[model samples]
Target: MNLSVEKCPRCKAALEVKENPSCKAIVIKACPAGHYEKEFHPALETYIEINKVP
Candidate 1:
């Protein structure tokens, strides 16, 4: 898990970061004021490459 601090893009407030309860690989970052939300997929590239069938 990346412990780096992140700021909200909309309001520039410090974001709250956490791992999704259902999926450990996904990281959730969101604004406390509901200005922004995002999910980080650490293995998305690997998953895409593995699923690309020729």
Candidate 2:
């Protein structure tokens, strides 16, 4: 899988990837805005996966 970094939507701050386990397809992002979001693959009904980093 390809990994990338991105910015937070709420505060437009830089976001970093905290976790990406091989057992799971979820990715955790921590922003400088103190906001946190999870990105999941397989396109969940409510969650969206980030494709690229800025």
Candidate 3:
């Protein structure tokens, strides 16, 4: 079972993760209040904009 890293940052409310069986068990964490966080981000542009390999 994947655990949430922390409680809701906005309201500090309890969070729960639900799996969508129809969608191939996609995990979604949510709080009682309408608050959510972005857990994924692609850095393609960032990689092109900044070259760290020197």
Candidate 4:
């Protein structure tokens, strides 16, 4: 379980992901600073799919 702090694009707040799944997409919540975390799914080799919360 790797925990990292990610920056929110909206307000630049520090976000974190506790557990990262190997074969599934994970959703990160927004911070108290009004920054929304972006969703990400890792693909084979060197590909990634990013999803944003509308």
TM-score top scorer: 1
Better of 1 and 3 by TM-score: 1
Instruction: Give the poorly placed runs of model 1, Cα more than 4 Å off.
Output: 1-4, 45-54
lDDT of 4 by residue, 1-54 (tens): 335666666666676654556534654454555435444534422323243555
TM-score winner between 2 and 4, please give it: 2
Give me the displacement of residue 11 in model 3, in angstroms. Answer: 0.3
Q: Pairing residues by index, what is the TM-score of model 3?
A: 0.44
Question: Per-residue alpha-carbon lDDT of model 2 for 1-54, expressed as tens digits?
Answer: 324556676676677767666745565666754665555555564566444454
Q: Ten consecutive residues with minimal summed lDDT in candidate 2?
A: 45-54
The sequence of per-residue lDDT tens digits that candidate 1 reaches over residues 9-42 is: 6677787875577998877777777776767778
Clashing pairs in 2: 5-53
Q: What is residue 52's positional error in candidate 3, in angstroms?
A: 33
* TM-scores of all candidate predictions against the true structure: 0.61, 0.42, 0.44, 0.33
What C-alpha lDDT, on a 0 to 100 scale, does residue 20 get in candidate 1? 74
lDDT of 3 by residue, 11-33 (tens): 77665665556654334466556
lDDT of each: 0.64, 0.59, 0.46, 0.51
Error (Å) of candidate 4 at residue 28 is 3.9
The full ranking of all candidates by TM-score, starting with the best, is 1, 3, 2, 4
TM-score of structure candidate 4: 0.33
- Please list the residue runs of candidate 2 whose C-alpha ends up more than 4 Å from where it truly belongs after superposition: 1-5, 20-24, 42-46, 49-54
Better of 1 and 4 by TM-score: 1
